[model samples]
Target: MTSVPTPDPGPGRQSRPAPHDQRSRPVPRPRPPGPADEPFDLLGIGIGPFNLSLAALADGVPGLAAAFYDQRPDFRWHPGLLIDGATLQVPFLADLVTLADPASHWTFLNYLKHRERLFPFYFAERFHVHRAEYDAYCRWVAESLPSTHFGQQADTVRWNAARGLFEVDHTHLDEHGEAEALDRTYARHLVLGIGTEPYVPEPLRPLADAPAVPVVHSAQYTENRERLLAAEHITVIGSGQSGAEVFLDLLRARPAGYERITWLARTPAFAPMEYSKLGLEHFTPDYTRYFHALPEQVRDRLVPQQWQLHKGIDTETITAIHDELYRRTLDGGWPDAVLTPGVSVRTAGRLGSREVELHLEHAEQGTRSRLVTSAVVLATGYRERPLDRLLAPLGPALRTDAAGRPAVDALHRLELDRSVTGRVYVQNAERHTHGVGAPDLGLAAWRSAVILNDLTALLTGEEHYPLPVRTAFTTFGLGGPPPAATGTATRTAALRHG
Candidate 1:
């Protein structure tokens, strides 16, 4: 098997450019048109962690023909937000395939072993690995997995009624990212894992686009760090983990008495995440099952009330920020920094060629104020990328919820017309149907296993990946007996004599 050569380790995140000569590269070449006629067992649209997990697991199953495609030249995960010392919130066990198949060669432990860092990682006793290291581990898997194809952009997907398969059109890009050729392939099943994109609120959207100042989403913080630090004043918007990390980093880098930074959030407070033992059960498969069974209205109402589950800052990050501020006061002076919650940007305008004026409002107090800053960082989080354009061909066959979002079933299949026999699966795109676990890394392996099991069940008569009978100790709802109960309950009505 051919393999992509790994790049040398560097001080920061590192990635190798595609080979200058495509002919000599190990990257998969477009197959002949006649060979594309043979349908694959599974064709994945995106190569994010979720699909990467599926590919890793699928590699172990014999005779399973699977292929994954990504538009980028190589794998890179949130590269800009990989702040130094930042760690994944999930444990290392939440890697691509360990939770589902611990014996798999693609596990994080295996990656460490391959890199000769196993002993050091073992001695560190770190449950949460650094974010940059995780990215590197994913790249290692992508480079090694034969089923993954990079530099291929999936343009369209449509069901072929006559062929009883799904046809996917793609453009194969050359080393320089120019479209060199177009190709089409067929598949019996499809999985969409395009993932989410960073979002900037309406009030700050203009500033983020103008680029006159150092205004950027926290997703691009690393790229703009030097310019932001050199500015006279900086203001960070949003109180989530990313906002906190950026603020903390800037605070530490600036002089104690001249920090000149302001942090603002619309949330009532800079809250710590709900990381208690029982509180975390919401991320388990059990909770996902319960959420999927909920009525549309109920699920819509409940999601906003559970913001602390996924949107709050980690306790450690909050503590680090506080500790840095406290340490600055050791010389009998406070740091020149302001941290305010319950505040939001109402409107923003340019004060001059280089300064930004933000009109702010306090939600609780109903007070208003204005502030001018040389730079702004919006860490307002991300939203699911809309699938309308990609799935436009099959729009008529899709079933949508009250809000017009695709209605995803418990099995993660998009509800579609009965005429469409080939299944359309999704990953990290069903938060309304699957709850908070939809995008959580800890659930990636398990979700992949679930998808594989369902697909195999349809192909054969039995499941390929036996799902765990139970995952969480807490039962999610009261309508049914606990999952452990063997007996089934029957409801009967007493009829009155006429």
Candidate 2:
């Protein structure tokens, strides 16, 4: 079998110029780098971790032209909340390329080796690595792939019936900081991984534009951390991982400094996620089947009850926060950070030059108000961007659930209108149809494999790479060695599921 050449590693996050002709050097022209006018078999909309995985999978496939585009000036995955002590919620094995191919050149292990930290990391015996480390690993992959275009945002995507292809329109600024609408690309398949936008409630939307209030989301916390660190008092809204992490980070910023923190959350208590080994099967292939087989009402009911399990922090992170709280208490600090559980921020407005007032309420008690100095960080999380904005031209042929999220096949292909010829796939936005694993890291490789298999099957009428079938505990490596008597049965069962 043939393989794609491994890309070279480099420092910094600048896009490499297209390969040059070595025979005779020519003067550079004022044109955008990379293949802008060229047609491709696949055009990925966003270069986040999900599409980055797909890019790795596509790298090994022959004659399968693909390129990814991102609006950011450079690749950055959650830079705002990469707190000094913050680590990933999932294992390091759940990185961009590991599960797809353990021997992948872009594996996190390879990244550690490149940085000469492999020995140190293993000695650490930590399943979860620092988020900063993962960010570095992603940047390495982005730097190697010269085909990726940064600072180029897709303005519009429309299906061209006459051309029998999807046309993507994008705009990027020139080196001089002048905006230019220079090109478009036609593709047989389009993968939309545009990610999500921070979700601010209706009451809080006004604060989104309030510069005085400093109503920034958790995603931008790093950029504004200095401002927040200088504040006398701050209020952090929401109780999810981001909210909790931000709260903790603020509290520990200046070990002995005086900075009051108010943590307003809707939940009665700060809950850690349920992540027992067997319980994690809900995020495995088996759970995808179990979830898909359940009745619509039952599935809907289960989602909210188990929301904490899939949506909250891992035990390690929870424990760290608990330890910090304990240490502060032992130091006689007594957690100047107040946890107003079961309370919600109703409205926020600027009080004066550097102060802000917030309307807060408790379900059991009457509504009340409070004032705080400096800023309010809204770690309210994110919401899936409406695919219809991109799929409107193709909406008539698309399928949706009662909640309006796209209805996708097992292969991750959108069930589109009959007029749609070539397939369109999605990632990071399938929470409803595919269950919790839709935006999960554990299933990134598996999802890519499924999508690739579907495409290959469409092209060659054969399954190229399929998902592994799950087996019972003893036989499938879940428990002991496979039973000698049912080895054949196990394989058959595995094949059936795949």
What's each prediction's clash count?
Answer: 0, 1
Task: Enumerate residue pairs that collide in model 2.
Answer: 397-417
**Residue 320 lDDT in candidate 1:** 96
The regions of model 1 sitting more than 4 angstroms off are 1-36, 480-482, 485-498
Model 1: per-residue Cα lDDT over 1-498, one tens digit each: 000111112122222324444322443434423223567778888888998899888777666777788888888899999999999999999999998889888899988877778999999999999999999999878877767777777788899999999888787776688887777778888989898899988998778555678998998999999999999999999988999999999999999899999999999999999999999999887788778878999999999999999999999999999999999999998899999999989999788789999999999899999999999999999998888888899999999999999999878889999999999989999999999889999999888887887787677744566555556788888864334523321010000000
347-460: candidate 2 lDDT, tens digit per residue: 777777677777777866776766564678888888777776656767777887776667876667788876878788888776666677777788877677666666665666
Candidate 2 displacement at residue 376 in angstroms? 0.8
Off by over 4 Å in 2: 1-38, 175-178, 255-257, 293-297, 331-333, 364-373, 471-498
lDDT of 2 at 295: 61
Q: Record all residue pairs in model 1 with backbone atoms less than 3 Å apart, i.e. clashing.
A: none
lDDT of each: 0.82, 0.68
Candidate whose TM-score is highest: 1
